[model samples]
Target: MNTKLIAALSVLLVAPAMSATSLDLGYKAYTSDTRDDNAGAYNQPFLKLSHFNKADWGTLFAYVKLENPGEVKDAQHGADGKLTVKSLAIVDKQIGSSNHNLWMQNFLVSNRTVMEDNLYLGLTTNQKFGDLFINAGAGINYSAASFSPTNASFDGLSGAAAVINARYPFALAGLKHSLTVNYEGQFGRDGEHKQTLGYDSYGHQLITTLKTNLTKSVYTKLHLTQFDSWGATPNDGIEYGIAIGMSF
Candidate 1:
């Protein structure tokens, strides 16, 4: 196993003993060849651990993601195909105990040469009608990027972008199914990379997923994701991949 994978697994193993209010463990494999430069296609296997705790207003969340163990081949170009950590605080309110309103703020950092850090703030509205559930949200994202010192085309870059997403979930054949679509567009620049604006400039990701209950505490998931702009630029050719995941 890769060192990153082992480390992620170690965290998951130790998290439950930390007196967590709630904890989730997951493992997945993702493969795709979509990028602006096309030289950065990668096959990534990763692990995730999430912890949630009740807070005064709502919930406190912490997430850890590990990918690309020991510098896998073809992994770069802002993919952040490395170690990443995220922290968020979310508040959700129910309207008459039916509709839901959610607000969250998060910060993320990664050890990546293309892009290293990001911040996100968003709000979402969720509703269920009959057997269908839907969620929509919009947010602001700030991201910073870095490049190698040997061959530099553009210096380090940073920008603020608009992020929007929607998700629809329903049941199919007694299995849980969902489709999520996300869009990001940059309007302002924080660095010299002003050419990074337009439709799908920041990102356009679509994911379809199915989850099957295997046991009370174990479930299997199959998902497909199309990363339209891994570099947040057009003509980057859609990078698509399928992932099989298990969660507990």
Candidate 2:
């Protein structure tokens, strides 16, 4: 009775009889603006789930976050609210077909740990050319300086970031509508060659996004962000969000 345990019990009895399924749970919302005078208005809501593995290496994403009408230009304003948890590994073949991909995370759980960075690399993707999904990766960032509370144990963050993405879809028989876009940039070696903690603190960031996926589990999104720093100054931000999430 041991032909490799009867072929591992007939591959777990035909592997759930041909398994592949989606939709575990989701709800998302977003709002943002740091146009200065009014000084950063924000609303962020998130929930996500993913579990569907079919010889498909890995996939397990979990999330919960909330930030609304929150503001603090000079700094500190009660408990504004933002919670998070994440996990992901979705690589579906291609040193041969070029569906290129990679995502690995250690600690990206944040609220503020001086500025947040306990060791990182929480966002990563790679794929160039159309099945219509491009990719890039980056991480390791932590900062402090909102109005000088003397919290400069400085190692201030971000020395890497790159992004470019696109996604497209239209379906009928099973129902589907998916469209997405992206652009991102960042690099640095923060904190004064001396010691003048103003706030460019040290930076460069540009982000744009859009997303929709009705069936295959459901989705929704919108985002925009821009920031150029080094005290040279230019801080522009905008974000509007929606998410009806689920995927497996």
Candidate 3:
């Protein structure tokens, strides 16, 4: 048993793993309960669906999500868009021994339920250099709302927006773990040929999320988000949330 012979044997032992890949399906949920001294306790919940498959080029993925019984929508008496859905696809590849991923998701829902519905398109590329991964991307959003105490019309109005995201991943207890930070921004104006929404601007949100696997078919996540706006007619605020789910 010589040193060179041992070295060659080691490479052979690990080479099989290099050719093998993985694919898994799982569900995730985020639910939060809050208590306000001046008001009653409140709750908001969301669920996410995910698919991941490995390929020669990279890993392919699809994810879907929905937010139900949200804070503001409840106050509207259920006439608004009470559910928010999001869909995404991306290619993830490892580079220079560091994992890299390029992905995008379109969020098809809005804070205002009566809106004609909106889409937030986000594109990001991340590189893992050791324990921390760095990512940056651009996004766009657009939507218009219809509101009426009896019967209202906002179909005439429309808005456009942009977004960005950053994340990092590593290992915990021999399992994968990640921390994600996201930022979303929207530009307000009229669609087709209409005046701006007051010649003013509206951009919202700073969010943080933590992700990990609970089991082979289950995963968990926690998130917090905030919305900030400028000017009067006061259109802005902050929010907190938590959730967990099982994946298929």
Candidate 4:
């Protein structure tokens, strides 16, 4: 990891410690199958740390994943024990007489293997429908190479970006279960940009997760993801994984 990324990660890891009451932390171990043509098909284990916090002003969610944890070199899918960090935050704001449902959202993603940093900024709204909760937003995206040796031609003003996150909770067979869906899409890239990126002008990643609580602090999850015209090379495939985690 670079010095800047390391610094940002340090702040994320310590923020929850500073405000325990508002933060929820969890750890998960999962094995996912990658079906990307260039990345090839491989089953790799990852250890993930997730943190969520809801404050009076807004909310924060972040996660860090250690991919191919046991490998130092030549790991599965060329992971090389890389660390991936993603963080999303919403700042509550109200326009005129409207309720406090309007907000500004920011998302940051950093990956060493791909040597890329992605960021999105836009306005968002929160809504509820019976037992389901949703947060949706649309904005502009900026993507660039984080370091040298990576193609930077596609960097700067990648295109339009949209994000949707929804969750529904219920009790099933006396167990508390929740279903969550998250989507991230990018489009509106010019022809030259698309050609340089080696992907379609539009792309998206949709992930659905079903989580069931085994105990007050323990849970298991099943994850399914669809990658269409996504990634640095625009890999398209379906990936699935199972995970066990504990939240506190």
Off by over 4 Å in 1: 1-36, 52-62, 72-102, 107-109, 150-202, 230-248
Give the TM-score (vs. native) of candidate 3.
Answer: 0.53
Residue-level lDDT for 159 in candidate 2: 56
* Model 3 lDDT at residue 71: 31
Of 1 and 2, which scores higher on lDDT?
Answer: 1
Q: Which stretches of candidate 4 lie over 4 Å from their true place?
A: 1-36, 72-113, 146-153, 190-197
* lDDT tens per residue, model 1, 50-139: 555443233344566555545443355544455434333333333344444444434343444333344444566665666455655555
Q: What ordering of candidates by lDDT runs from best to worst?
A: 4, 3, 1, 2
lDDT tens readout by residue for model 2, 1-248: 12432353244332332344443332332233353422323344444444443334323222333322132212224444434343222222223334443443222222332222222334555554655655555655433233234544444453554455566655655655655555544455454411333344344445454556665555555555554542212354444445555555
**Residue pairs in steric clash, candidate 1?**
none
> What's the best-to-worst order under TM-score?
4, 1, 3, 2
- For each candidate in turn, give its C-alpha RMSD to the true structure in angstroms: 8.2, 18.1, 13.0, 5.4
User: For candidate 3, lDDT tens digit of each residue in 134-201?
Assistant: 65544444443443332343433245555455678767897776788877665664543122222235
- TM-score on alpha carbons, each prediction: 0.58, 0.27, 0.53, 0.74
lDDT, candidates in the order shown: 0.45, 0.40, 0.45, 0.61
Screening candidate 2 with a backbone cut-off below 3 angstroms (N, C-alpha, C), the clashing residue pairs are none
Off by over 4 Å in 3: 1-42, 51-64, 69-105, 110-113, 120-128, 139-141, 150-160, 172-175, 188-200, 229-234
* Model 3 global lDDT (CA atoms, 0 to 1): 0.45
